[model samples]
Target: MADRVVAHQGAACWATLFTHAHYLPCLAVLLQSMRACQTRYPLVVMVTETVDARTRERLARMGCVLRDVDAWRVPHADGSLAFERFQNVWTKLRAFELYEYERVVMIDSDMLMCHNMDELFDLPLERGMIAAAFACTCNPKQIPTYPAEWTPRNCGYALRPHPPNDARQLTKPTYRLINSGVVVLEPSQEQQAEIHTFILRHTERVAQYRFPDQDLLADVYRDRIQMLPWYYNALKTLRQCHPDLWNDGEARIIHYILDKPWLLGPSPCGEHTHLHSLWWDAYASLAAHPATLSMTRDEWANEIALHVRGI
Candidate 1:
C-alpha cells in the first residue's frame, strides 16, 4: 500500500491572565477546564501582573508555564474596568507574536470548559477571527460605527474617573457581543500588524469608554470574522437561547457569566436546581482536584478567610 499522508499538526497555544488576587481560584477553574480538554498542545502560557508566592507555587506545581508582565511597562489607564481586562488580551496578543506557534487560543479566567477546543485551531483564523458572539450593541450599528480613535485614548468615549453604573449592570443584549473570553487568534506578520494597529487605535477607546471593547472589535472586523456556537462561550445568554441544549447534558462548556462560580459559586437559574447543581458540582470538583491547585483544605480555608475580611 502507498504511504499515507499524515496531516501537519501545527502547534497551538492557550493564554489567560490573573491579576486581581481574589481571582486566583477562578484562574484555577480555567486551568481545570483546560486540563479536561485531552489535547496534546504544548504548555499553556499564562500572563499575570502580581501573583503571590503561595499562589505562584501552586501554579508551578500544576505544570503551567507562567510569565509575568512588567507592571511598570504596562501603561496604567486610570479609568475603565473593561480596559483592564482587555489589556491582558493585548499583552497576550503581543507575546503570541514572539512565540512561534501555528495558532493560539485566548481565554479568560471566568470560563469553564467541558471538551477539547483544538477544533478552534482547525478553523482558518488566518483569513479572519473566531469569536463566540457577534456585535452586541447599537452604537456600533449606527452611522460611522467604528470610530477612527481605536487606541485607548482616541476612542470616542473619553476616560471617566468613576465606573458607569449602567456598565456594571448586565443590560439587555442588542447586537451580538463577541465574548472576549474565548477567541482563536492566528498570528501572522500581517495579522500582528493589524492587531497592533487595532489595539493602539482602539485601546484608548476601551480605556476611556465603558462597554465597547466587543463593539469596537465588531466594527473593526465587521467583515472578517466567524461566529462559533454560543455553547463554546456558554454563559447566561446560552441558557435562554437553548434551554433544552444547555440543560440536556450536551453543552461542551458551562460558562458562568453573571454568577461566576469562582466568585459567587453556582447559580439558581430560574429555579432550575438541577442545572445549578450540575454547575456547582463541576466547579467544586475542579476546585478540589490536585491538577488545578495543590492547596490543602487548611490552606484553602485560610485563603477564603482572608477574602472574607478583605485583607
Candidate 2:
C-alpha cells in the first residue's frame, strides 16, 4: 500500500478551465462563489491563447493563478488532424499536469457553489479515487434513446461492448456516469502520461463519444471513482426530474446544465427559474463590487436581453 502520509502530503487546490472570452462573466461569478464560501485552497484557471489579455487581467485581479495550455485537436484514424471536431475540452486534461498540488478539484465555470464543499478533499484518495456526482439522467422525452423509465438506481452503468471490435466482453457495473462539471483528482505525473497515451492510442475511438472528456474520464476511472452525494452537483434538471433530492439550501453546488440561466428568458414557473434567479443574485454580488464595477453595464444588459429575447 502506498504510504497514506506520502499520498496525501501536498496542498490541494481548486481549478477551472475556459477557452473563450464569453465565459469570463461566468468564471467571475464562479470565483465569487468560491470566495463567498471561503474555500481554503488556492484557485487556478487554465486558459488557451483564445482568452484575451483583458480577460486574463480581470481573472488575475480576482486572485486566480492563470496558466496557459494548448487546446487539443482531434486526430483521424490515419494519424491526421480532424479540423471539424477540434475541441477546447482537451485543455481540461491538463488538470492532471498540476503537479504542484497533491489533489485538484476541477470545477466548471458554468457551476455555482452554494456552500463550502471543502469536505470533498477529505475523502480517500487511494488508487485515484476520483470523487464526482452522477450526471442527471436525461429526460427520455427529450432524448428518445434514453428511456423515461430509467432512474438513477437502474441507470448508473450499461454494458456496452469495447470499441474497434466487439469481440471481448466486459461486465463490470459501476456507478452511473459522472458529470465532469466538478471533479476531484490527485495529480500524478504517471497518470497524466498514461491519459495522454490513452487518448493518442484511441484517437479514432474517442471521436465517437458525445462528450470526449467526460466519457474518457468516466471510462478510465469507472469503479475506482468515489460517488459524492447528488447535492455536490445538483443539476438544474433535477428540480424537474427528481424534486425529492433538489433542496437549494442543502445543495453544495448548482450546475447550469443545457440551458444556462444567463442565456434564458424569465419563465413563469419552474424550479430552474428559481435557480436562475439565484444565479443572477450571485452575478449581481460580483458586479456590485467596486473592484469589478468596471464590468460594462452593456455587457450585463446584453446578456440579459439575449436570453430574454430568446436570441
Clashing pairs in 2: 156-176
Query: Candidate 2 lDDT, tens digit per residue, 1-311?
Result: 64332333568888888787677667777877887899988788988888889778767766889988877665433322222233566678789888888888888888898999987777676665687776555453364434344454443322221110221232223234677888888888888877777777876677565556776788777655666677788777877776655677988988987667666643424556788888877776665663553445565455322333232
lDDT of 2 at 132: 77
Off by over 4 Å in 1: 1-8, 42-45, 70-98, 135-177, 199-209, 241-247, 265-276, 286-293, 303-311
Under the 3 Å rule for N, CA and C atoms, how many clashes does model 2 have? 1
Summarize candidate 1's per-residue lDDT along 187-280 as a digit string, tens digits.
5687667755765776565454433434445556655545665556665444544344445454566555544443443454454345455556
Report the Cα lDDT for residue 97, model 1: 59
Worst 10 contiguous positions by lDDT, candidate 2:
158-167
Q: How accurate is candidate 2 locally (lDDT)?
A: 0.68
In candidate 2, position 275 carries an lDDT of 86
Worst 10 residues of 1 by lDDT: 155-164
